[model samples]
Target chain A: MTYCVGLLVNAGMVLLSDTRTNAGLDNIATYRKMFVFEDPGERVITILTAGSLSVTQTTIARLKDAVRGPDVDAETSIMLAPTLLRVAEIIGNTLAAVRADVDEKLVAMGQGVSASMIVAGQRRGGEMRMFLIYPEGNFIEATEDTPFLQIGEHKYGKPILDRVVTPATSLADAQKAVLLSMDSTLRSNLSVGMPLDLAVIERDACRVTLRRRIEAGDPGFRAMSDAWSKALRDGFAQITL
Target chain B: MTYCVGLLVNAGMVLLSDTRTNAGLDNIATYRKMFVFEDPGERVITILTAGSLSVTQTTIARLKDAVRGPDVDAETSIMLAPTLLRVAEIIGNTLAAVRADVDEKLVAMGQGVSASMIVAGQRRGGEMRMFLIYPEGNFIEATEDTPFLQIGEHKYGKPILDRVVTPATSLADAQKAVLLSMDSTLRSNLSVGMPLDLAVIERDACRVTLRRRIEAGDPGFRAMSDAWSKALRDGFAQITL
Candidate 1:
């Protein structure tokens, strides 16, 4: 299980993901789920993935392979894609293909391959966009009405997003909403752990602007956690019979 | 879809359930999921059901029938159960049997029946206990660690419970936690809808002491909802990037 959320706000875009991946309760491991592709100053794309580590790691490795390969056309590559939509399509196709291959090999043991991703970014002159790419080579764009996308262990964190998020929100506020959302998830679910990966992309910048890693004992996060605990206690106290 | 939650605290047991039932997006209706059986001062058992409405309604109806019959016994009754544990066992066995019977008729269409329930109450001179009963006649008792149980649209509302709830929480506070939790689910899931039934049984009282129905236009609920929205917005503003 994992938790990844991406919000497209008027000022910029905020993306956050937990690094924990567990095959079982005793087999938990930390693995970065955020991937960035940058042709700096021209285009910058970030992919946050969730699900089976094998499928996620393989799909990302393949995408990196495409980036380092020859400058193929859009039909043959993700880097040459003209738009974010096309980039998402390419990612979805690759993810689906990787899943199919892995699933086939695992068939003997009756295993399965499952993975999904949040793909968001901007081209030099194109608008900042976000999408949720499914494992079946399909995707849905986040529009003004929704403005955000979440994947994996999503339900536990969804309430905060529903109550506080909107497209008109500022990038700074969006960052807190997402981090708090991730905090709520990490508290309730054992499969989602710390050492989170957070990234911010200012609209049309075509480069990563803000990036931070929140470790287990980070003071800022610790303060936020304590504040939330206090707020909940106070809030509960104020409610009447 | 449904959303039902129960909290066992030192002050009492609080049970809340939404009355919405849906076969699909196009087919939704109002169907009460909370059933209370009490012989005041002797025993009180509130069962909050989720999953197959047919299975749950039938199970409750059967239990009612047995209680109303003169031949009541531990082998065929809920009202005569010796302890809250036995009461939960009776409900679980009934749910599994009802599910199996309903499933038999739907097997040709490849459909199935299933139900889960939260049983919370006390028998005279016994402790206030809570059990989350599964469709297979198996159940788990709530501990100080978990403290509460939720069924149906659970994910959307779990964060708040994980944060502020505890075995020492007051009954009134538990009600608020559950109502806010249900409100969170209502916003995110259209399948879970209005007209909630709330029941409170004081610890060792052996019967439901208070009950309320919050309709769609209930003023008190509306006020609480608005206040919660404002609190979330304020919280978002108070946090720095």
Candidate 2:
């Protein structure tokens, strides 16, 4: 299982994903899921994926292949897609194609492969839009009322985000919201593990302003975990029957 | 969709379930999900179910029928069950039977229906026990590591419990933990709606000590909602990336 969250805020976008994948409990492995496509000042599009590693890894390989291809164009790849929507379209097409191919092979063993991604970023002039792409290739955009989207072992982490995240939230705070969100799930579920990838794209910067990898024993994460525990205990105490 | 939580703390057991049912987004309605069977001071059992209403309601009806029968016995009923575990076994078998019957009818239409419940309470002279009954009649108890069980739209509210709950948590604190847990899910999920049934059973009481139904505009719930929103905003501001 994996947990990936993408938030579109007035200050920027925050993307976080855990790197644990498994065919089963005993087959667990760490595999990073955040993919960044950047032309530095020109554009910075980040994709955080969850679900089948086969589908996401292959889809990402194809995206990278397109980026390196000499004939890359608005119609052919995310690198030159001209708009975030077009970039999403390009990614959706690539992901769907990869899924179809892998699923066909897995059908012999009665297995099905599926994957989804949160695509978010800023271009030289366009707005920082965020999208939650579905396995079927359709997508939903994050609006003011609900400024974030999450995938994978989502339930355990969703509460904090639902209560706190907003478009007007600061870039730094948004990162904390996602981390605390992920922290919640990590404690409840064994399928989701550590070595998290976190990226912050400041509004209109057209580049990732900050990137972090939080490991199992990171001090900052440890502090946040401890603080949250104290807060929950206090909150419970203050409530009346 | 539903959100029901059952907690087994040292103080006792707390069972809470939201009363909302929806066949589709446009066809939502309120339906109680909690059913209590108590020969007060003797045996007190409460079931909070989630999933297909048809299956769950039917199962509860059968159990009620057995309890009301004059020939009730361990072989034929829950009222005469030898132990709390036996009562759980009876409930699980009946729930499974109901699910199979409803699922068979729905199979022709390609629709699926199944349900699960959190059964918690104590029999006089017996230790308090809690079990999460699955659609297949299999169940697991709440251990020290996981002192609570939540069914239906569980993810949205799981963060708080992960951060704070333990078996030693006081009953008062556990109650607040669960309400906050449900509050998070209610905000994020439209399918899981309002008017919650909350029951508190102090350990060894063998009877409910407190119970209340929270409606959409319930004063206490409204106050908690506002306070939580403020605390989350404050918490976000206090944290750094």
Candidate 3:
């Protein structure tokens, strides 16, 4: 189980993901689920994954291979794709292929593997876009009315995002919104653990403006979490039932 | 798809349930999910159900039959049970039996049915008790550390309960907590809908002290929901990144 969120606002895009991965409760491991590919001022693509680790890792590895291949083309490589939509198509196809390949081996045991990802990025002239890619190779984009996309263990963290996020929200507030969303998830679920990866892309920058790895006990994250909890408690106490 | 919660605080017990039930997204209808049986000032038992409509409705019907049966005894009837635990056992066993009967008929269709329930009440001279009865007849009681039990579409409503509910929480506050919790679920899920059933049982009263049916346009519930949303938004705005 994992929790990853991608938010696209007028100011920029914010991506947050937890590092915990588990085949079962007893076999838990920490794995980075966020991948960044960039050509600086030309283009920047950040991928946040959740679900079967094998499928996600293999799909990402394949995408990386395509980027480094000598015959790199827009059709085969996300980095060279002409638009964010094309990039999403390439990643989605790769993810679906990898999942199918993995599922075949697990089928005999009545098991199957699958994964989904959030693709957030921009090209120099293309508008910033965020997509939620399904395991079957299809995707849905974030729209002005609904500026956020979440994958895996999403329900616990969703109420806050539904209440606070909007297309016109500032980049700083978007960061806070995603972090607090993750906080709610972490407290409610054990499978989503600490040491999170956070990335912020300023609009039209074509590069990540802020990157953070929040480890357990990190003072800043801890302070923000504590403050949010206190504020909620105070707010709750004030409500006249 | 339903949302039902039972909370036990020092002051008493509170039970809340959404009236929505659905066979699928296209086949939704309103159905009561909360049932109360009380021998006033002696014993009171409130059951909040969730899951397969067929299974839950059947289980409740059977329990009611046993209560009104001429051969009623502690072994077969919840109302005649010697203790709150005994009542839970009767309910759990009946639920499991009904589920097994229903599952058998659905198995040929490659489908199965199951349901769960939260039973809360106190018997004369017995301690107040709350139990979450699983489909297989097993049950777990809510304790001081976790004074609440929820069934069906629970995650969306859990964070608030986690933060606000405790054994020492006042009855009035507990009512607010459960209502706000339901408010969150109602907003996040389409399957959980309006016309909620709320029941409060004050300590030692052994009967429902307050009961209300909150329709879709109920003014008091609307005001509380609106105030809670505002409080949450304000709290989110005050948090710093």
Candidate 4:
């Protein structure tokens, strides 16, 4: 299980994901779920994945291979796509193909493989965009009314996002929103563990402005989580019955 | 769908449930999910139901018939049960039986039936108790470390309860905890809706101390929801990035 969120706010996009994976209670492991591709002033794309590690890892490997391939084109590679939407399509296709290939082998053993991802980035002159790509390859974009997308163990962390996020929210506040959102999930769900990857893309910059890997016991994250918990307790006490 | 919560606090017990029921998106209606059975000065039991309405409604009906039957005994009737645990067993068995009966009829049509319940109460001279009864009739109790049980669309309302509820929490605070919990579910889930039923049982009283049905526009409920939303937004604003 995992928890990843992608936010499309006015100041830019914020992507956060946990690094936990498990076969069951006894086989838990940490794995990075966020991937970044930046051609500086040309284009910048970030992917946050959740679900089967095999499918996501393979899909990512294929994407990287495509980037390194000599025949790279707008139609074949996310890095060369003309629009953020096309990048999502290329990634979605690759994810679906990899999942199908893996499922074919695992299905016979009574096991299965599947995965989903959040694609967020910008192309030099195009609008910044974010998408939640399904395992089947279909995708949905973040709109003004609902400026955030989340996958895996989403419910525990959703109410806060529903209340606080909007397209006009600033990058700093957006970062706080995603971090606090991840904090709620980490507390309620054991499958979503720490050492998180966080990335922030300033609007039209075509590059990630802020990137962070929050390890367990990191002072800044500890202080923020402690403060949020205390604030909730204090706020709860202040409300009249 | 439904959202019902039962809390076992030191002061007594608090049970709260939403009233919305929906067969599908276009087939939504309001129906109470909280059922209270009280023999003043003797025993007081509250049942909060969630899942297939057919199964829950039928189970409640059968339990009522058993209580009113002429040949009622300790094994056949909840009112005559020796302990709160026995009462939970009676309700669970009844629910399981009713579900099986309904499933038998629905199976031919390629449908199924199942339901879950939270049974909370106290018998005179007995300790206050709460149990979450599964569809199979197996049940688990709320202990000192975890003094709350929730059923149906539970995730949205869980974080607050997880943060604030305890066996030593006061009755006043307990009531606030549940109402606020229900408020969170209502905001996030369309299937769990307005007009909530709330009940409180004081320790050793063997009868309900307070019972109220909060309508959609009730001033007190509105105030509480408004206060909670404001508090969350304020807290979000105050947090450092």
Candidate 5:
């Protein structure tokens, strides 16, 4: 299990993902689930993955290969795609293909492999956009009405996002909202663990503006989590029935 | 679908439940999911249910019939049971039997019906207790370490309960916590809807101390929900990350 969220606000896009992966309770391991492809001021693409590790890893590997291979073209390479929508389409199609291949191998065991991803990026002279790519290769883009997309272990952390996030939220505030949302999920679900990957892409910059890896016992994250908990408790104490 | 929660605190027990039931999105109806069997000061047992309607309704009907039957006994009637633990056992067995019967009928459709329940009650001179009964008739009691139990569409409402609930929490505060929790669920899930039933049982009293049904437009509930949203936003704004 994993928890990855991408928020698109007026200022920029904020993306965060946990690193824990488990075959079972006893087989837990840390694996980075956030991938970035960027060409400085020209274009930037970030992908956050969740679900069967084999399918996600293979899909990402193929996408990277398409970007590096000699036969790279706009149709095959997400990095070469002319627009954010085309990039999403390429990633979705690649993810769907990889999932189907993996599911075939697992069919005899009455099992299937699938994965979903959050795609956020912008190309020079193109609009910034965010999308949630489904395992079936279809996707939904974030709009002004609901400018956040989340995949995997999403419910425990959703209320805070629902209450606090909007299209007009500033970049700094958006970062705070996603981290606090992840904090709630971490407390309630053991499957979603640290360290975490967080990236911010300023609107129209076509590059990742700020990126950080938050680890367990990281002082700043710990302080924020503890402070948020205290504030919630205080707020709860003051509410009358 | 339904959302039901039971919180056991030093001051008392608080139970809240939504009344929405649906076979499909277009076939929605209102059905009470909370049942109470009380002998006043002698004993009081409240059951909050979730999952397949047929199984839960039939199980509750049979329990009521046993209590009203001519040959009522400790082994057959929950009201006559010697301890709260025994009452839970009786309910668990009845639920398991009813589920098995229902599952057999649905087997041809390759579907199996199941239900879960939260049982909270106390008997005169006995300890207060709450049990989460699984479809298989097994149950785990709420303890000091974790004094709340939730069933059905539970994740959206869990973070607040995890942060604020404790054995030392006051009954008034407990009610607020559960209602706020339900408020979060209502905002996130269309399946869990309006007209909620709330009940409070004070410690050692063995009877419901306060009971109310909050309709969609109830002024008091509306005010509390609005205030909570405001407090949370204010709290989020004040936090520096």
Candidate 6:
């Protein structure tokens, strides 16, 4: 299991994901789920995945293969695509195909594959966009009315996002919102653990601006988590019955 | 589609439940899920139900018939049960029976019956107790380390309860905690709606000491919800990115 969230605000885009993957309680492992593809001043694409590792990894590998192929074209390569929407379509179709192939082989053994992803970035001359692509290859774009998209262990972290996020939020504030959202999910769910992968892409920059890894026992994250717990207790004490 | 939570603390017990039930998006109705049975000075039992309305309604009806029957005895009637555990057992058995009966009939239409419940109260000579009863007549009791039990769409409201609730929490504080928990669930889920039933049982009283119904336009609830939202936004603004 994993927890990943992506937000598109007026200033830019923020994406965060946990690195824990488990086949069972005793088989837990850490695996990075964020992948980035960028061409300095031309285009930037970030993908955050959650679900069956085999499917997501294979799909991403195939996507990279397409981008590096000798005959790379607009229809087959995400970097060569005309718009972010087309990039999402190519990724979605690839993800669906990979999942179907994996599921077919695993079905005979009473096993299956399941995966979904968040696509966020900008391309020169094109507007910034964010989408949640499903395992079935269809996707929904985040709009001004709903400026965020999340997948996996989402409910525990949703209330805070629902109350605090909006399209006009600043880039810095958007990062804080997603971090807190991930914090809530990490505390409530055992399957989702740290260290976290975080990235920020400034609007229209067509490149990644900030990328950081919050390792276990990182002071900044610890301080924020403690501060949040204290604030919640204080607020709880202040509320009248 | 419902949200019901029950908490047991040193001071007593707090139970809150919403009254919304839905057959589909187009078919929604208001139905009370909390039922109270009290012999005042001798014993008290509160049942909070969630799932198939047919199963729960039939189970409650049968339990009432048993209590009112001429041959009612300790083994057959909740009011005459010696301990809260026995009362929970009686309720659990009844629920499982009712579910099986309902499922047998609904199976012809390719439908099924599913229901679960939280039983909380105390008997005059026994200790306070709370149990979450499953559809198969099995149940798990709440302990001091984890003093809360929830059923139906529970994740959205769980983080707060996990942070604030404890066995030593005061009755007043417990009530506030459960109400806020319910408020979170109501905001995040469409199936859990307005018109809530709240009840508190004092530690050795063996009966409900406080009970109230919060209607849709209730001022107190509205004010509390608004205050909580404001506190969250203010807290978010104060945090550093």
Error of 4 at A79 (Å): 0.8
- The TM-score values for the models, in the order shown, are 0.97, 0.96, 0.99, 0.97, 0.98, 0.97
What lDDT tens digits, residue by residue, belong to model 1 across residues B105-141? 9999998888999999888889989999999989999
Per-residue lDDT of candidate 3, residues A100-206 (tens digit): 99999999999988799999999999999999999999999999999999999999999999888999999989999999999999999999999999999999999
- TM-score (C-alpha) between model 3 and the true structure: 0.99
Full ranking by DockQ: 5, 3, 4, 6, 1, 2
Q: How many Å off is the CA of B238 in candidate 4?
A: 1.9
**Cα lDDT of model 2 by residue, B19-45, tens digit:** 999988889999999888888898889
- Which candidate has the highest DockQ of all? 5
lDDT tens digits by residue: candidate 6, B124-188: 87999999999998999999999999999898899889889999899999998988998888887
Every candidate's DockQ is: 0.63, 0.58, 0.83, 0.73, 0.84, 0.71
lDDT of 6 at B175: 90
Q: What tens-digit string does per-residue lDDT give for candidate 4 at B1-241?
A: 9999999988899999999999998999999999988998899989999999999999999999889988888997888899989999999899889888989999899999789999998988999999999998989999998899999999888888888888889998899999998888888889999899999999999998899999999999889888888888888888887
lDDT of 3: 0.93
Tens digit of per-residue lDDT, candidate 5, span A1-241: 9999999998999999999999999899999999999999999999999999999999999999999999999999998898899999999999999999999999999998879999999999989999999999999999999999999999999999999999999999999999999999999999999999999999989999999999999999999899899888888878777
**Candidate 3: residue A33 Cα off by (Å):** 0.6
> What's the number of clashes in each of the models?
0, 1, 0, 0, 0, 0
Q: What tens digits encode model 3's per-residue C-alpha lDDT throughout B8-74?
A: 9999999999999887799889999999998899999999999998898899999999999898888
- Worst 10-residue lDDT window, candidate 2 chain B: B232-241
Q: Residue-wise lDDT of candidate 5 within B146-195, one digit each (tens)?
A: 99999999999999999999999999999999999999999999999999
The pairs that clash in candidate 2 are: A155-B155
Q: Model 1 Cα displacement at B13 (Å)?
A: 0.7
lDDT of 6 by residue, A24-105 (tens): 9899999999999999789999999999999999999999999999989999899999989999999999999999999999
Candidate 4 deviant stretches above 4 angstroms: A109-111
lDDT of 1 by residue, A1-241 (tens): 9999999988889999999998889998999999999888898999999998889899999888887776656764667798888898889999999999999999999888899999998999899999999989799988888989999999888888887888888888888889889988988899999999999999878888998999999999888877766766665566554
